[model samples]
Target: MALTGAGMSTASGIPDYRGPTGSQRKGSPMRYEEFLHDPEGRRRYWARSYVGWWQIATARPNAAHAAVADLQRSGAVGAVVTQNVDGLHQAAGSERVLELHGTLARVVCLGCGAVVPRAQLDRRLRAANPGFAEAAEGVADQLRVNPDGDVDLPEDLVASFVVVLCPVCEVGTLKPDVVYFGEPVPKDRVERAYDLLELAPALLVLGSSLTVMSGYRFVRAAVRRGQPVAVVTDGATRADADGVLKVAAPVQELLPQLVSRLASEPADALSASR
Candidate 1:
C-alpha cells in the first residue's frame, strides 16, 4: 500500500503547508471550530476561497501522480491512499484511491444536507459577487493560495465581499466538502483505511511529513503489526526511525524510476524481501 500527502501535488504547482522537516511554512490554517462558530471567519474564508479556486480548478496531475497510477496498474503497488483533497490521483487515472480528507470539488449545505459540485457553487458565487475575483487578484499580495484553496485578503476586502448561501437550502451555510484542521476524519473512512492497511504486506509512504496524527497513526500501526515500512520523501518525516527504510529524495523524480525497478524484479523475491 502507498500513502501520499501534499508533497505529492507540489509538482503540480500547489504548495505544501509544511516543509520537509515538519515545520509549518504557511500562515495558520482556519480550524473547524472557527468555520462553524465564527460568522466573520466564514465570510473571510469564502472570499479567499473564491479567489483561490481558479488555481485548484486548473491544476493538472503531475508526473508523480501518473507514476503511482502506473505502479498500481503494473501490480507493484496495491491500495492507494492520500491525505490530499486535490483529487489529483483520480485525475491521473489511478482507480479506487481513498481520499483521507474529503475533496474540494464538492460543497455541502449545512442546513439541508445537500451536496453539490464546486463548479456549481462557483457559478452561484460569481453571480452573487460580480467582479470580485478580478478585484481580489489586484488587491491580494501575490495571490498566494494555501493548500485548502484559501488566499489571504485584507480585512476591508473581506468585509466588502458577499458570501452566497447554499442554493439548495436557501439559508444554510455552504462549506467546502473537506476535512478541516481540528476536525475528525469520518469514522467510515478511517475504518476503510485500516482495512487497506491490514491487507497490505508492507507500507510505502510518499511525500508526507506525517506531522499530524491523521497520517502518522498509519505508520505507527504498520510498525505495531510488524509490517515492513518504507518512506521516500524529500524532507524529514515522523516515520524516519528504526523499522522504516527512509530515502530522502524528491518523489516526482524517484517514483517513476522506483516503479520501473520494481516492475523488473521477480514477484517472489519482492514478497520474500517484505
Candidate 2:
C-alpha cells in the first residue's frame, strides 16, 4: 500500500508544497540547482527556509499514521511506499517502509556528501536569522517547506537574507538528499519498492491528489498488473479514472476508520485468498 502526498499529512496539519491550496507563496520555488548555483537564489532560499524548517521539524504523525502502522502488525498490509519526507510513518512505528521522497531527518553537504543531523542545520539557521525563532512562531500558517527546507515568502524578504555557505565546502552548494521535482527517483529504490509491490495482492493508495507523475507511476503499474487499486483523497486524482475505487475524503478523517475496519475483518472479504 502507498499512502502519499501532503494530503496524507494534512491530518497531522502539515501543508502541501505547491499553490494557495498547497505551500508555495509566490513565483516558482527554487530547486536544488538554483539554490546551489545562484547567489541571489540561495539567499532567497535560506531566508524563507530559516522559518519553514521549524514547521517541518515539529510536525508529528497523526492517527492515520498510527493506523497504518497497526495494519502492518495485523498483516493486512504487506508493505508501505510513501511519498512523504516527514518521517511520520516511522514515528508511528511502521517497519517495512520505503520513502519515495526521502526523509528530512538528515542533511548532506552536496560538495562532500558528508551527512549531519538536520538539528544542527536548524540551530545554525536560527542563529543566522536571529529573529527567526520569534518570526517563525506563526509563519508556518502561511508557508510550507520546500524540498530543501526553503519556503516561498514575499519577494523582499526572500531576496534580502543571505544563505550561509556550506561550512565544509565554502564554494560548494548544499542540497538535501531528497529527490526533487524534475529529478528522477533513484533506480535501486524504485526497483526495491516494485519488488515489494509485487508481493501484495493489490495496492491501496490514499490521500494523494496525484498531481505529479512520480507518485502516479506506481498506481499505473498496479492497475496494469490487474491489482485492485483504490484512491482516497480530497480532490480528483490523476489515477481516479483508472483506480478500481476512489473516495473523496480527508485521509485523517477516513484512514484510521478504514484501516481499523479492514484490519479487523478477514482478508477473504476483500477477495484475497490465502
Candidate 3:
C-alpha cells in the first residue's frame, strides 16, 4: 500500500504546509468552526481562494504522480491512500486511490446538502466580483499560494471581499469539500484506508511528515501488525523512528527511478508481492 501527502504535490507547483522552507502563510488556516459561525471568516477564505484557485486548477501532475500511477500499473503497488485533496493521482491514471481528505473540486451546500462542481461556484464568484482576478494579479508576485487554494492577502482586501451563497439553496453557505484542520476525517474514509493497510504486506509512505494522526495512525497500525514500513520524504517525519527504511529525497526525483527498478521484476511476482 502507498500513502502520500502534500509533499507529493509540491513539485506540481502547490506548496506544502510544513516543509523545509516552512509554511507559506504565517497564521493558522481558517478552522471548520470559524468557517461555520463567522461570516467574516467565510469572506476571507473565499476571497483568498478566488485568487489562489487558478494555481490549483491549472496544476499539472509532476513526475512523482506519474511514477505512482506507473507503479500501480506494474503491480508493485496495491493501493494508494493520499492525504492530498488534489485530484492529481486520478488525473495520472491511478484507479484504486482513496482520498483521506475530500477533494477541492467539489463544494457542498451547508443547508441543503447539495454538492456542486467548484467550477460552477468559480463562475458565480467571477460574475459577482468583476475584475477581482485582474486586481489579484497585480499583487500575485508578492504572495504565495498554499495547497488548500488560499493566498496571503491584506486584511482590508479580505474584509471588502464578498462571499457568494450556494446556488441550490440561496440562503446557505457553500464550502469546499476538503476536511479542515479541526474537522475529523469521515469515519468511512478512515475505515477504508485501514482496510487497505491491513491487507498489504508492507506500507510505503511518500512525501508525508505524518505529523497529523490522520495519516500517522496507519503507520502505527502497520507497525503493530509487523508490516514493514518505508518512508521517502525530504524532511524529518513523525514516523521516522518506526520506519524500517527511510530515504530522504524529493519524491519527484526519487519516485521515477524507484518505479523503473520495481517494474523490472516479473509482473506476477510483483503483483503477489508488496
> What's each prediction's TM-score?
0.94, 0.85, 0.95
Question: Which ranking of candidates, highest lDDT first?
Answer: 3, 1, 2
For model 1, residues 47-139, the per-residue Cα lDDT tens digits are 989888889988999989999999888776888989999999999999879999999999998899999999998898899899888888787
The ten-residue window of minimal lDDT in model 2 covers 18-27
Q: Regarding TM-score, does 2 or 3 come out ahead?
A: 3
| Clash counts for the predictions, in order | 0, 0, 0
Q: Which candidate is the best by TM-score?
A: 3
Model 3, 151: alpha-carbon shift in Å? 0.7
* Candidate 1 runs further than 4 Å off: 20-26, 266-274
Per-residue alpha-carbon lDDT of candidate 3 for residues 1-274, written as tens digits (9 for 90 to 100) = 9999999999888888787644666667779999999988889899999988878988889999999999888777889999998899999888899999999999999889999999999999999888887777775676677878888887766776778887877988899999999999999999999999998889999999999999999999999999989999999999878745899999999999988777677867665665
When sorted by TM-score, best at the front, the candidate numbers are 3, 1, 2
Off by over 4 Å in 2: 17-20, 23-27, 132-150, 169-171, 263-274
The lDDT for every candidate, in the order shown, is 0.87, 0.71, 0.88
By TM-score, the better pick of 1 and 3 is 3
Q: List the residue pairs that clash in candidate 2.
A: none
The CA root-mean-square deviation of candidate 3, after full C-alpha superposition on the true structure, stands at: 1.5
